[model samples]
Target chain A: DVKDCIIAYFRRSLQQGGGALSGKRALVTAGPTHEPMDPVRYIANRSSGQQGYAIANALADLGAEVTLISGPTTLRKPAGVAVQDCETALEMQALVAAMPVQDVAVCTAAVADWRPAQIVGQKIKKQSRDDVPAPLELVPNPDILADISAPSPSRPQLVIGFAAETENVEAHARAKRLRKGCDWIVANDVGENSDVMGGRENQITLITEQASEQWPRLDKNDVAQRLAALISERLSGKIDL
Target chain B: DVKDCIIAYFRRSLQQGGGALSGKRALVTAGPTHEPMDPVRYIANRSSGQQGYAIANALADLGAEVTLISGPTTLRKPAGVAVQDCETALEMQALVAAMPVQDVAVCTAAVADWRPAQIVGQKIKKQSRDDVPAPLELVPNPDILADISAPSPSRPQLVIGFAAETENVEAHARAKRLRKGCDWIVANDVGENSDVMGGRENQITLITEQASEQWPRLDKNDVAQRLAALISERLSGKIDL
Candidate 1:
């Protein structure tokens, strides 16, 4: 009778710790990577890192251990979550590779596709109106999403990537999901008229192997909460990836 | 006797309004220009706008009518100063041309020397690792410093430009002062080791037609105050420009 009472007490304590994501681990990437052209100049994007930070907080609220790897952003670090900052795509790639495998991985950083071929040691001088500088030589940066989503023993159970498209949002995202070998892809329109990038609100379509569902425009925090809930259900075997 | 008393009262009020910079109009440019490659991406620099903002505040404290033209930066606007924001170097150029002639103009912004030849309408899609993109094309941007320094009827009485140099600081700054036809050039080292670019402390060399003097490392605010004093001296005919 004493042994039975101890077992019941432990079970109740575990349930009280958290609901669905009690034992889950998550890795999240946010913000925009800067590709250095020189000591002073750089190529960068406009990712605010708000959504990624919100998602990390949401998952942690559900008792998931979340680690956020971010590029340069002014956002404050989320409470109860670990955060690491990186400047370039290559730096982020190395950190991601070194991290331990997790139950879920969310890739939301707008990594630069190309970087200057070489970083000039000195500031390039502008001679005169007659003198024109040569065109900028560029080379492709590493594809982090594809590398992480590749099927391997070390790969996470669920890998999700964000697709910022200016046109043909859903079709491009579906193709990207299959191409990157990720479980799901979140697609959003960032057309000239869409106030999505750096904005507070987001309208997204979550594309999965089963179906694609468009969500209404909502605050970035709400989007993060909704996505985190779905992740918990899927990880708990209540729904498919 | 009554008229003389009224004139004396007016003179006292004028003296109380401010010290050396009283009744002067100044235009200051700060921050780093962003040259857009596309809607989401741009070319930028490491300017924090601290030094320029400090200069604006210092000038205003001495009762100068200050108007600040700035690029993108996270720094808050200084009190008692008019601020106009711009993105690219071209846009800043247009705004500068539109402003009324000022008594003094300080060019401190690290404006981009070049911008993308064309801004892409849509985000450039990253296809695969093998799909290499072409090199980026760049075009020369209008030289605002040289334009403002050239002799003109509406030119400011005093024009000061900032020179960010790594080596031969004095020589480069002197050369810049002569080439741009500016009254003075504030030169600072932004070498790999120097922490002056975005740091609170700064070491500067003031280059003028008469002499070149290097000051010890001090807070950016102190540099602004010292420079403002010199500007007042020059404007009041106490010192040579």
Candidate 2:
């Protein structure tokens, strides 16, 4: 249904000289991954799925067959997109591993870094006022971006990750790209009261291999359009490869 | 009044930390510059003064005499900090130059790279839809990070710049640090979803001469606290010139 809406939009765009994304296959991950502590509790971030939803809409506008692996969110299903729902980081990883090869993969989900060492079948009761601060052991989660970008048989042609920052925006983002082994890292300043998340407008700096282009903050939809256009251009440029 | 507020906060932090940021003077630039297309139609970015404002608050909490040069925003003035307001990049440059020599400087503002070649006194009227787009010529603006990091009487002991990227996050951030002659760069991703802008939470990576540290997504206040702590620690670690 979402895919149909996107295709309808794309057909109209194609009429206006926008090229087709007929053969491209794209994957996107959105929202925050849950690291369950028990049957009733979990660790997660504040991702509302706005970014991922907008990207799916934008990619559909460009004619890409997009599959969105989304965590829990209330965002409307974008037109002309396929969505695979998952609850935990592990579940999301399994879904990614199971998917057929894709041309591009964008990991936008803010995956929890750690999970409880063991899942408790029942919810632990809070006993005394000082319940000894139950020591919850943590284990590291898989790096989805790095996994998708690795030289595997199903490695995506292009991989992108998000580096949201409040303080050291660029330095940290760059290191993340290197550590995660992704092709692109979109950096933003998420300091107090920033409008990028669950907000309507955004200003972004596009850091590519060759240049860093800064665009004025515009409506999120406009940003998506510009990004789609840029990606489409890059994809076309790489056709000979 | 804001200066007093910041100073008071710094005093309290000094009482807690004992010796960190004891004698350091830190300067910060915040907000966006407006490039005049005409008196009525000026170009500006959507910088909400959150990141810089939070930084000011955090720095004050770390026992530093903070000088904050801010662009237009409606945020409450942080207590115990000195602030200068400016509307243009050039004004920001002059203010930064006039400030007392500082131990560290963080250029967090989304400073405009280009300003209108000429600030037209009167607004230009749109002739017709058929008329070719009006060419508003642009002129380069000074690179604040580059200018401050260069050898000069007012050069800071340590300079930091924010690198916001959409692709190749680490490579571009590293290159930017080198190009700008800054000691540190905070690289972050402002992916298509705008996770980092005008949001209350942020995730960041810190890049320095030592190594890169990836911080999980955290509240803006926590980020400010951590960054301030790190800056204070590092400044103390350095040998006095």
Candidate 3:
């Protein structure tokens, strides 16, 4: 019954000349990537993958062929979307790199910036109580978004990145857009009491080359829907670029 | 229908006189605490609350009155268990400290050891590109397990703590038991490929004063059931202390 309802909803939209993203292909990366410390331990961020999954579902609902590349999360697969599960940052990078050119690419993953330089074959054991903490060498991971946004024949028409900031949300987001050479950046404050990391609701600022638009707090799904609508407008040339 | 089934199952267990934990009261702590960085950011760990929630559900099935104190997690509340949500380690400690003595207490929370000493009232702002990374001053949080395990008139009969170790699982667990003054410690390897932090399955070593028992990798719920059974046996005087 639910499946039929969803089909009917989409059919009605498709009949109106075109669904928002009909025939468009989208690549969405969500969740937090784990950087292996050894065979048994990893460094990870607290990203529940709710926002990214919601975005994938929203894009799918608008008739986009969505490929969701996700990190470790307990969420069920979004219906009608192709899913790819990944663990470490390297795995995510490899998967994204291998994907075909897309109309749009949204990088929402909280990718770990650093990973252990050497992954120990065995578990790194704890030493005597008096001994110092084990030394771990870390190296910067590849910047997936930057690579995807690079000037290449296969670059997506539009590349969007996310910046989860603790302070100076707008300024930092603007800086990140320039630094990464991405077309747009969705910035949000994940400060204390914001409940944005793993909570249901989010407030975001959409930073474009021309301007930054702020949206009030809303449920993650609603945010995704609104973002999808904006993406549709941008792709359809309904709004000034 | 689900509630009715659960009630029926528990009722049947109660009629058997020694339902694994009949008349027992349990306290469970789960998930990762968020220590504030500023108005919008926090320092937190990756704890899904799956293990603790599973343990709470398992104990409830055995006719124990379970109270789950959880941090931020997307998990649904376990059926028939009273839940208290908390954000920081301090809040969790307060809740546990104020409770009436529990028959058994399980500390599965990955509590943040330190919190920002001065929580900025507004969102922290990023400085110039040449500026250094923000320096965060941290202060130690109260150790809930140690406080609960202290020699108090209302101390729980059994106090169990968890040691999520990357290496030397047994030795660290053994040391933890003595340092925290807890009766038992559940030690687990969370190394590179283990996927233990947010994964569904876990392998643990249960360490007591006299002996240590290693359990094969099992689903979190199965591990909880096994642990509950062990607790039941110990309380019934079937297993030596």
Ranking by lDDT: 1, 3, 2
- Whole-model lDDT per candidate: 0.88, 0.71, 0.82
True contacts kept of each: 0.73, 0.00, 0.08
Clashing residue pairs in candidate 1 are none
C-alpha RMSD over true interface residues, each candidate:
1.3, 24.8, 6.4
Higher lDDT: candidate 1 or 3? 1
Give the alpha carbon lDDT tens digit for every residue of A215-239 in model 1.
9999999999999999988888899
| Candidate 1 residue B209 C-alpha distance from true site, Å | 0.6
User: Can you give the DockQ of every candidate in the order shown?
Assistant: 0.56, 0.01, 0.19
What is the per-residue lDDT of model 1 for residues B82-171, given as tens digits with 9 covering 90 to 100?
899998899999999999989999999999988988899888888877576678888888889999999999899999999988778888
Predicted candidate 3 versus true structure: per-residue lDDT over A5-66, tens digit per residue = 67646644653436779888899999988776555445566678999999998888888888
User: Which portions of model 1 show Cα errors greater than 4 Å?
Assistant: A1-16, B1-16
lDDT of 3 by residue, B1-241 (tens): 6985777566446635567788888899999897765554465666788999999888888878789999988798886678999998989988887788799999998876566677676654434323333444556678788888999889998999998887777988899899889999999888666899889999999999998999999999999999988887887789866
Alpha carbon deviation, residue A112, candidate 1 (Å): 0.5
* C-alpha lDDT (0 to 100) for residue A219 of candidate 1: 96
DockQ value of candidate 1: 0.56
**Candidate 2 whole-model C-alpha lDDT, 0 to 1:** 0.71
Question: How far out, in Å, is residue B8 in model 1?
Answer: 28
